[model samples]
Target: MTGEPEGPDFDVPVGLFEDIEDLKAKLARLTAQVEALTGGDGAEPGEASADEGEAAGGEAAADDAEEEEWQYPPFILLLDPPEYDDELRALIEWVEGVLVPGYLAEPSADARWCHLWWEHPVAIARLHAVWLAWQELTDPASCGYTGPSVWHRDHMDPALRELRGSTGPFAGCVKGEHQIDHRMPGLVPSAWTHAED
Candidate 1:
């Protein structure tokens, strides 16, 4: 009008945006519409629902209850002298029937037989029998070989191939700096006698 360049208004109408608050309301409406179109129900992005939490909690509680209900009994090894004797005899018969034959039949008979010197089934059975006899003969209260000392680590059987390796009980006694001697010397008979030893 006043000798000014009359330019045509190029601004397009971008809906009913009046003030800053009105613009914010329009933006929120558009966001909701976009969310609905894109399969959003206003739930948390990555968190599980209330029902899922309840189920998980129930399962955890059930597992805890099961664990709480579990029980274990005390193990009894040797109760009385009579029971010990019976068990010892049974164990001996089992060794004689099962282990002795297998030992005799093994190939490399000399090496295998000599190896059995450390831990023979027959010898173990005899040892068990002797322990039972000792228990019967001596007073239970005054016996030196009371509780589990009679079946201690040293008295137990050595592993196979004990002569080759430094791992077995025999190796510990023989090779190591320990003065290991047979209690009864000549009384304790040797099972296998190698020519060298």
Candidate 2:
């Protein structure tokens, strides 16, 4: 009579699960902080709203919990993650009404961003930051025309450094200082896009 515990017995660090839960809570707090800083509240980003969160019953809740570990930040900006839907609608209108038609092609391909890039999580999140800053910064009375300059220096520059760095979205695709080429619709960083790896 072998007394081995079960089929998949594995050594785990004591209190590891507790530690992980603690980390998740901390991360959720940070996410909430970012949301608050950017004007949001309640749970973290990418989490479900009240209906989806509560209506999950049982199986759906587990499924959501499973996926929650992997989801990038949702493309939402507001006081609540539940507002993601509304913000997405607004973002769609803005992108379609402004960013796309006038921005599809640029003077330099390196500066080109695919409208489809909106589908990428990183792009969505980064652009959300830019858009939010633009909203407050571009108020004519706030900073005058220098608003855009401030936003570019504060937000856009940092985002671009990551989004277009040597190892960023256009990594391996950027030809030189002035000519990044994208063969595909999305320009996600290889690290984030290559989940299979």
Pick the lDDT winner: 2
In terms of TM-score, the best-performing candidate is 2
Point out where model 1 deviates above 4 Å. Answer: 1-79, 104-197
List, residue by residue over 114-159, the lDDT tens digit for candidate 2: 3355555566677677677877788965468889789878986787
Model 1 root-mean-square deviation: 28.3
Clashing pairs in 1: none
Q: What shift in Å separates residue 23 of candidate 1 from its native position after superposition?
A: 70
lDDT (0 to 1) per candidate: 0.40, 0.57
Off by over 4 Å in 2: 1-82, 101-112, 157-161, 164-166, 170-197
